[model samples]
Target: MNMHNTSSPVTSKPEELVPSRYALKIGDIDVMVVSDGVLPLPTAMLAHNVDPSARAAWLKEMFLPPDAFDWALNAVVVRSGSQTILVDAGLGFDPDLHLPRAGQLIKRLEAAGIDLSSVTDVVLTHMHMDHVGGLLVDGVKERLRKDLRIHVAAAEVKFWDAPDFSHVSMPPGFPDALRSAAKRFVKEYGSQLRQFDEEHEVAPGVVVRRTGGHTPGHSVVRVASGGDRLMFAGDAVFAVGFEHPEWYNGFEHDPEEAARVRVQLFKELVETKGLLVATHLPFPSVGRVAADGDAFRWVPVFWDY
Candidate 1:
């Protein structure tokens, strides 16, 4: 399978770095940011949590698409020695969903030299559709391997799997699906599924940071090798200028907290000068955060495939 170079600013397909796929090396670990598909929200839907005037002004300046915002779905796969770890599973090939660019993750993994059977662990930062949709495959359940262990934050588990989650005012048709998916995973993983708190080590050279607020337990991935670092900022920021440290999606479950978490994450990125990966910020979705005056901008790592 082939992928369009979502990271290419030149508007042409990029060269294949993994020979047959997409894999970037930081040091000892191989990081592959794979696509799940795209999720398009009507312009009206995005205006949910922000003031209409502010939203209007921002859209006009950015020259956004007609009547909608397209969010790219992606997940990161990390390989260390023989350990294969998947950051998040994307939306599987769901034909019913006409996301022109959706559901191609497993194929991308294959191109990157990763086999689903080889994945030992799957870490879910949250239960959002874009992040968790790839968990469930056709005949098999959400299990990556026969015994793949699924890891998630305890709060994340509680939020989606909770019986009373319906009481909360979420997007019109989302609460039901979220709850349904949570239950399905619970049944599939059984004892192989587990949960952690705020910060914990999910795998070698990987630390899970609980950067909540987007959802109850939204988290981010921090990876380090030979003292070099990379932060996989999940659904924390939108691609079109959400790089201003505090600029975050209004859909965030806890907007104020999301802003605080993004600022803190940006601070860490600045101090470390580490590579950064954003799930929704374009494709080949890895870049660096740099201070532009008081705000921040994403400097895409062009060298990465």
Candidate 2:
């Protein structure tokens, strides 16, 4: 959910830079994570943390700079008949996250022709800049509809809404913009909030489940249609290339615990043939987890509808 940050915001507008990315369609449901744009991850630094040979191969094949790394930020959108849900809202002009190709979530949303007022529900897995960035429009609370069923995990609600959550709030830890949105959510729109826990149905085929480790209250949603299922795994894995099941992002507050959940969930995903939709594993983020060698490989499928 957390993208590496700089103290200052990027001057380049997201729409002016990276063209929004998309990959859509699955069964009776049409799913896509419209891109907010890409973020520059330090390649040399990230590679140093990864397997050198794998890093080298990706540097050549994946078009990554030998010295720097860049990753696309894609927040998910699910459409089942008239029920449209955005899983994670993208980066919303936060000066703190200091991202190039930033603040493109709404444009991507508009490209999909989904009206802000018509969004029936917004399932938030956890509150992170890239994940919840589009929740509040740039500098305006009224821009985001309060009538939408803003689904949040019970554990997440307790933490972000808790008085102690202020340290992580904006202003203190470079999240000044989000702090305002978070405060507005806790106060005026509290009635629109409908709390959920692990393994509960939010919509007809949409269900939320706990996959803690990334964040204390972090969860994933399973959208089932015509016997097929697609899972929205928010920040469970970053970087499009797959690696050891124990692989994790450095920003995960709890790497060990996240790894455990990943290992277990991956096993289930392999068995179910469920679509593994990672927020950061390239745009559209649609893939299938397969047993490659001793670990797993993320097979990014070319999806269209």
Candidate 3:
């Protein structure tokens, strides 16, 4: 047998090896989770307040690398009646960070047959670069509809005005990068912002609600229709959060409050039995929460092929 199949057919176009988008329905509404790609970060970003050995043990339990790992970055697109809402844009190109794997949202959206012009509104969960940088990508704004309404917590925009980095524990250069991204985003698209005080319905069943924690204006989007429900939790919850609800993510501006919000959201999920899709959770992050002793358990929904 030949060592190499030199005669194999070659195609002009190559497709991705794995699926990047997963679509599901919540009653009458349609939701699709699109992966922007992954960000490799120090494991210490997971919980700054915990002991190194404890964190290492958790990593061991999960069979993950103890030092650093790739964090999944997800963005959601929701369709309700006549409105198309984009939630939490993924990390858009940051050359200085040398994170070339991330910031693939725009192209991924195109691959998924989602057009920027079709988006009528944008519901931002927070002002973090990973959550809003996609909008700042070159040519993105020009492609968006002129009347596009970007819904966000008024508090979020205000917080970025004079952001407080004293509490966060991110890796070096993160704070400055985040600050620059937020400032540039505001300067570029300030006119389109639709700042809301507490909660606002983007469409018939899609409501964005503020639950300040990770950031002063960090929020979550709740989608409900008929009898089905789902929530797109921004950074309030992480993969480690379900088991270690008290652990503080390095990105959280107020770690204590973020922990509280995570537990509270878990209780709410347990009570309502709503599907959970968070920004930092594994790809296609659809799941339900169950009370497991004093902690919580992540019950991922079966893939609906």
Q: What is the per-residue lDDT of model 1 for residues 1-305, given as tens digits with 9 covering 90 to 100?
A: 11233243443665443332346766778777776656777664444455667666767877886467777777888876667788988766445446656666776776555667888888887876666666666754543567787888888877765544322344455665656666776676657767888888877788887788778789888889987788888877666444334444545767667678777777778789998887776676778888777778778877643
**Model 3 Cα lDDT, one tens digit per residue, 128-190:** 999899998888999999999999999999999999999889999999999999999999989
lDDT of each: 0.69, 0.67, 0.91
- C-alpha lDDT (0 to 100) for residue 118 of candidate 3: 93
List TM-scores for all candidates, in order: 0.83, 0.79, 0.95
TM-score, candidate 3, is 0.95
In angstroms, the error of model 3 at 14 is 3.4
Which candidate's lDDT is highest?
Answer: 3
Which has the better TM-score: candidate 1, or candidate 3?
3
Runs of candidate 2 with Cα error greater than 4 angstroms are 1-23, 43-63, 139-146, 161-189, 303-305
Q: Give the Cα error of residue 39 in candidate 3, in Å.
A: 0.7
Q: Is candidate 1 or candidate 3 better by lDDT?
A: 3
As for candidate 3, its clashing pairs are: none
